[model samples]
Target: MEITSVLIYIIVLFLSTIFSYPFLKKLKWNSKSIPYKLPPGSMGWPYIGETLQLYSQDPNIFFATKQRRYGEIFKSHILGCPCVMLASPEATKFVLATHSELFKPTYPKSKEKMIGPSAIFFHQGNYHSLLRKLVQNCLSPGSLQKLVPDIEAIAISALQSWAGGDVINTFHEMKKFSFDVGILSVFGRLDKKHRENLKENYCIVDKGYNSFPTNIPGTTYHRALLARKRLSQIVNDIIYEREEKKILEKDLLGHFLNFKDEKGQVLSKDQISDNIIGVLFAAQDTTASVLTWTLKYLHDDQKLLEAVKAEQKAIYEENEGGKRPLTWAQTRNMPFTHRVILESLRMASIISFTFREAVVDVEYNGYLIPKGWKVLPLFRNIHHNPELFTDPQDFDPSRFEVAPKPNTFMPFGNGVHACPGNELAKMELLILIHHLVTKFRWEVVGSQSGIQYGPFPIPQNGLPARFWNESNNT
Candidate 1:
């Protein structure tokens, strides 16, 4: 553990890996090809690379500093891999859409291990296509329509509970609300106590998502692995219970159970558990962040709040005095509210970036994207670019009245790897907004503060806010 010994060990490891590179390449499963003409950028210090800067510094500043020096598209080793970061819509499109086949999906080792190999995010070719199709079918418009009443019920209950609490943490509350909705929508309405236990285990799993992949005892990743095992057990138990009782429920789990791919192969129990976890993992944080920031933005601007409230109020009246569950028709009619959601997503950039690995050496704007190197579509930079949006720093929902140029606003991401659950996430937000704006009055309790970005930007104060049922507003 001495410094000199540590340095010697690192040096030996580094050299041994380099010496064994050819042998590693010939492993049949090793997908890496010889990297050639890698884009201009620094690989940083040894194995650590530029990862420290990415995690330690503010993401905006880190990206901006690099962009200023290296131009829109530049190379930098980050997060344990050498990555070519793209900032422009054109480059984003090329990597995410145009030549998407040339760039396969890649994610952190921790994410890959935790989310499982069958999860859609890390998949490609026929397998990824099958998973995507299955997910789309489960979350289709008609399916969502059937599920909306339950979603509304959950939202109403959550908001009602929030109404009675004092000085609530808005982000935490929203996460719990969304997480609960995810559980119900995916697994059908199960026992409340079991659902709560599942939520607790999921929390541990979520925390380990961005942690180092090391499985050493007492590490976050170690805890996450354990939690993942427990969650798998819980899911398997539910599946077995449903089968034993001869219950066939119409929910995501049921859809997955009955789903057969082109190969006519049904998902195994482990595949089912892994994909379910992947669904929860994808929807939970981003949805919660969007909900929290939307409310926070609305709270900061009274005029905007009134405008949003008016929009919701119109929908409320249209639904026969707000007594009905939000149908798909009603959700589609809330154009202004949709614009607000889009604007909030533009500003918040809940998912800052996503990774893709070059399947082959690719050329872009005369630069070489060497095969096997990771490519990052910098969603945050693209969303915030002045060229893409005038006065990009300001929050203006009206801008969405007319869409920006194609691929200019990818909050959920772009191309085949784009989030499949975005509509569901949007529906969850829309429902929460409809209820919140129509039935509640809320305000921040203290002076507004900046957001602290850790994996995602969260209000530094946890967005402490006071709330009252709208009836008590006067």
Candidate 2:
């Protein structure tokens, strides 16, 4: 067993190094246009580029090394492609907003691999517009208000399960709650049995997102393949069940069933399922990660905690004796709570690098970017830039207490493809964190006590927290 484990480790490491070694040639590319611009960064030798630094988990090292060498906005390679690093607000806005049409993400595998090709996250052109329209319509403030009771119920029940003041993995807890909330909002309860089946089916696609490229037995990819099938089956069955009964509920799945395209061809059941799974992937995982870091920051900073608590207490008491649970109004009223979540998002975003495909040569800041060059905008670099954000390393919610600090903050991303579920995710984080701070307190353990990342980046430590009732705080 020991030998086998060592061999797997050696093989994975060997392949990783080989994967990165080819890009050294690209290092010779000239990028003198924005030599003295943007936040500092680098693209290392060959194909490895900045990704090797990304794999290092400590992102600051990438900037620390790059800032010391390349300054910023220089040519570099990442994910095995030669790309330019753009960080300033003007450059970023140009890519995400001004010339967004020219730089849409058309990568086949990016949509198919990270998120399924058909999922809303990867959809482009008219299809992207359609999916965004559906999501936006469904997630409108009026609809979200109705989801309050549903969200509150799930949150309360989850919190109740943390009975023993136990050392809880806040990250996993958040993921589970988020998954439940997202599923319910998207599909409705329908029935207890149907909901259970849908949840089971959901995991198949979820697992696929993280699987290796290979889809063979004994591989995580294989499990993901099976999971995707199961997830699809569950959604299909729900659609079939609803169709058979001539019943339509207001849930996301039902909404899709009733949707019509420009040509008026009804969306098929699989299409609906695929979009839900896609949105779920975007909403659940990212929100869970943000919440995990929010807890970490709240636990580490006592003043922030007290401030959040004070705000929450006032909000909770204002709606005193109301039996339907804290309404959406109550949740949004917690100013400090929202600020902390926003700050955490700025500090640690699950999506740090955004990929864009260039359709034509674009000129900016005196540099002509050739057509077809992959655009890689460093999301983290701008957000944590000390020049834009004071004492960037520190977790201070007050920085965002007013408005976002311009180019330095784009957590859900920016412009056209920015997460449509941004409002929903923010609401969930604020609501959940509000409940956690009032009900319990927590602390980190071990070297990994703080935040960490994996692949798309998640809290490496799972954000361990010691939970307790408000009585303990007293």
Candidate 3:
């Protein structure tokens, strides 16, 4: 009996060894295949992560500290998600442009709900491609050329309103101006009534966008969700009117309306409304924030402001003291002012970083980016990196005279998800700056040294300032 038991044990041991050999070999092969390590940095505490640490101080300081300690790429947990922050231009390009497929655009679920899930910002693949083409067509150079006179008119009107010298929040005023242009781009020559309705409802939605995402009644977020519904309805009303009148136009709404897929699919009304709101949301705050920073920067540097004024003044004189509408050629010719806008975009870096999610385990520069982790390309860090830009802290528009190194300057971002309306936004800036520098003088009011984030950094108190028409001053 003892011999039989010993024989059974020996046989079992031999069989186990034979079966486990392939498994052990496969494990060893996998280990050898993946030799990369996670990028160095703290993940903070579990669940809560480093969210408090991030929000407690200047986000720039937080990121700068991490980059200094851990080099360009580092790991941290923020807002309950483990993330990899990439501060190098090469890593940014790899994630945003080259290996874009390996990382997908990501936003908070609340944000997605507020912006609408079908908006091009939240999409990938064929749907995103289709929407992008339609938007590009709407804002094409041909379209923007026609828009110059109208945009000039908007700028003139905005300046005229601000000339009374009541200390107005520059950023708020810019919001109104950009929102109007956004409306024009979406709906060509919309009635004042419709425009007012859209603006009023959109303001509510905007207010709630960054509020805590609570659905309880009477909450700001709840109010925003309700206002979002009204916005959709307003868009639908416009669509219905167009269909009834059979009005075919060349605005963004027209493009969405006219699009037909190879499968003969017409976009749903909800889809149309979603994209329109998305465009407005994209166009308003960003353009306003940059314009506000431009105002502050120009105000702070009299010499630089004088130089930009000289450039625009030349065009203003050529146009016969603003009697003639700005020609597209004239708008294109303001090189100095254009550089100021570019530099403002770089210095402000309003979109400090962008969020993407790793779709699969990605090996980048000998580091392992595990699947499902959030990846942030720190645009502000890259833009401010002294190595990338000499004395990045100073506001020097001339640095842009020489083109930045490849993948180094992405004010409007890069790759498939880059801002489609970048040209339009720049055109708006040129027109506004031309009118502003040539016809108006302004001083930034109150303390000018602090920054505030209404989700985007603007000068403290919205750069409170007073404006005077040049003619009025004279």
Candidate 4:
């Protein structure tokens, strides 16, 4: 009787173990798979989510404070969306370069409507590739070489206009200069009347770009929409004229007009018009802002300004004291001036951050970034990192004498969506600075210390300043 009872107990124990083995295995696997937690930091209040806090203070301070407290990657809600801010170079590259397919560029719908939805920056895949190729082709090195003389002419004209001893808003004047250069690239010497029309309507659109997005009559945004329609009409008129004349030149518009896909599908008028306006929009503000900052920096640091002038003056003398147009080779060879531009880009960090939306739940550094959340690579945070840059706050062009780490210096951003117009922008800056420093001197007027953001940070009151022709003084 004892042996039979022992046998029954052993069989029961064996059957129980067999039944529980699969359950135990599954539990272990589940624990490993679900271990990730959301990153650190405050999401602010429930609905508005720190939008007020962000706008209420200097944006750089807000970001820098957060970085100090919460480390490189942190969670916050802004503009009514949950976001994970990536301040480290590795994280930035992961989102923007390595795993870019997992994230898509995101912008406010109002901005898309303002800039037109078909713009290259708003897209990915084949459509974006097509537009980017066309843009790159027109702005290529060879093409830019051809544009040097024209850009020089525009730069000379701009400096002359600003040299009348008026306390002009430097940022505003720079905007006009950049707009003309933008026009030259897009249309290649557009007629004065069409240029004026585009400028008038574009200014209205610019005013409403950051305004509240409401279609109610008389609102800034509403007026902007009307202006946008008129701009489209103007672009269409130009297209018609080009077609009628059979004008085929190597400009942005020419590239657009000449494009035909393997399917023989050419870009539509809306595509062309939207892109033209988009290029103008892209070309104008950021370049103007950077140029404004360059002036402010140079004005504040006279020693550095003199150094830049010395470099440019040598080149100027070579060109017979500005009698000859600047050559592409001369522009390319301005090493010190190039470093100054690099330092300025780093110091200003004009494109502070860019927005990307996660298309899937992503795991990074053992943190869970849930799908449908916004991910912003804080370019400003990276640019201002003390570890990455020694004395990051101090304006030092010499730091750029050695190249920045792979992804650490992204003033123009990085990865596939990097600015195609960056070279042209650099060329514009080089030409403008060469002329301004060699042929002109300027004095900053008013309080020279505060910053204001007209959507882009500019010195307070647009760095009110007077410029004088040094040649005239001589």
lDDT by residue for model 2 (1-474), tens: 134543553355446546645543433334564343322344466434555454443665664456447655666655556567676666888888777888877553623653455777665678878878888888889888888877877877888786466777877788788998888778876678867776675666565564445657867666776767677777788788888999878767767888898799887766776787787777787888887777777766778788888887776666662343777777667777777777888887678778886676667776656555577677887786778888988888888767865566788778878888888888877777666666655566555444454445565567666666666663
List where candidate 3 sits over 4 angstroms from the true fold. Answer: 1-34
Q: What TM-score would every model get versus the actual structure?
A: 0.89, 0.87, 0.92, 0.92
TM-score of 2: 0.87
lDDT tens digits by residue: candidate 3, 1-474: 134543543344344434434433332224356778889999775445576677656789999999999999999977656789999999999999999999999998889899898999998899999999999999999999999888989999999999998899999999999999999999988999999999999999999998767799999899999999999999999999999999999999999999999999999999999999999999999999999999999999999999998888888788898788899988788888889999999999999999999998899999988777889999999999999999999999999899999989998889999999999999999999989988888988889888877779888889899999887863
What value does the lDDT take at residue 131 in candidate 1? 82
In candidate 3 the C-alpha lDDT for residue 201 amounts to: 96
lDDT for each residue of candidate 4 in 213-330, tens digit (9 for 90 to 100):
7799999899999999999999999999999999998999999999999999999999999999999999999999999999999999989999999999999999998898889999
Q: Could you tell me the TM-score of candidate 1? A: 0.89
Q: Candidate 4 — which pairs collide?
A: none
- Clashing pairs in model 1, backbone N/Cα/C closer than 3 A: none
The stretch of ten residues in a row with the least summed lDDT in candidate 1 is: 23-32
Model 3, position 409, has a per-residue lDDT of 90
Model 3 scores worst on lDDT over the 10 consecutive residues at: 22-31
Give the Cα error of residue 58 in candidate 2, in Å: 1.9
Model 1, span 150-245: residue lDDT tens? 889989998898886489988888888888878877888898766977898999988887665668999988999999899999999999999999
The alpha-carbon deviation from the true structure for residue 270 of candidate 2, after best TM-score superposition, in angstroms, is: 3.1
- Deviation in Å, model 2, residue 355 alpha carbon: 1.3
